[model samples]
Target: MQKFLSNKKLIFELFQFNQNFNFARNIYLNVFNKYQKESSIMKEQIKNFYLLLIILSLIALFLISCDNKNKTGTEGRTLSYYAGNWWGKASGETAEENILTINGDSSITLKIGDEIIIPSTSVTRVSDTNYIASYYNSTVNVSTKFTFNFSSDTQGKLIMEITQGSTSQSSTIDITKK
Candidate 1:
């Protein structure tokens, strides 16, 4: 009878241990499933973030190309654009018909009415759109300076300053490409 009771006690302990193991297994499965779901959600969020970044990068590239297309030739001014004939009338201090010619070699010729006042001479570049041509006549003790400022690809302004002894006179002319 004692042996039979011992056997029954051993069976009861085994059943209790099996129940406890089952409970622990259920808890482990639940935790694992929860973590799996959270990992899947995190992976989806990372994919979405990368997708958004690619979309924004494409939009930025498109905007930059469009901005470049809207720019005109004035933004990309070159020395060759100034090699042409310009005609205008001096209006400020002196009134006369003038023809200004810019050569391919960055030289200039100025004609006032029927006479060539300044011969072809090398011009000094002040900037991308500005130049100066200067002449001095020692016989008459006179100095002349012509300043050219190009505003666009085909339009410009010329200012002539003439100095004789201590007296100075200035004139302005609006010029157009021919």
Candidate 2:
């Protein structure tokens, strides 16, 4: 009878230990599943953040390109638009018919009547629509400055300043592309 009682106590202790181990395993499994769910959610959030960052970066690049286009004045007209023959008449000091020719090579010529006042000279662009050409005539001791401002693709205004010794004269001419 004594031996049987000892065996019964040992069985009870084994049963209790088995139940505690199962409880511990169940707790561990629950915690591991919760951790897996939280880790997946965190990964998705990081992916979405990267996607949003890429989209915003693209928008910023597009805006910068548009701004650069406007700043360079390349929206409506270009330097090639000013390359053509223009005709007009001087309004001050001399009422002479003038022919201003602009070449594709950035060379310009100004003719008063049949005489070439400004021989083919290189033009300097001051702005999107403004240009300048200068000439010094050694025979007449005259220095001439021509400022050309284009109002449109076909029309422009020309201001010519001629300085001889201490005397200076300015003339305004309205020109049209031919």
lDDT string for model 2 (35-136, tens) is 999999999999999999999999999998877655555554434558787878755534535477776666666666445544334456677788778888
**After best superposition, candidate 1 residue 11: deviation in angstroms?**
2.9
Alpha-carbon runs more than 4 Å astray in model 2? 6-10, 13-20, 23-27, 30-67, 71-80, 90-98, 114-122
TM-score of 1: 0.54
How high is the CA lDDT of each candidate model? 0.78, 0.78
Whole-structure CA lDDT of model 1 = 0.78
Worst 10 residues of 2 by lDDT: 113-122
Q: lDDT per residue, candidate 1, 71-166, as tens digits?
A: 566564444568888888756535434477776666666766444445435457677798778888788898989898989868989999999989
* Predicted structure 2, TM vs. truth: 0.68
RMSD of each: 6.1, 4.5
Where does candidate 1 stray beyond 4 Å?
Answer: 1-20, 23-27, 30-34, 37-41, 44-71, 76-80, 89-98, 112-132, 137-141, 149-157
Give the clashing pairs for model 1.
Answer: none
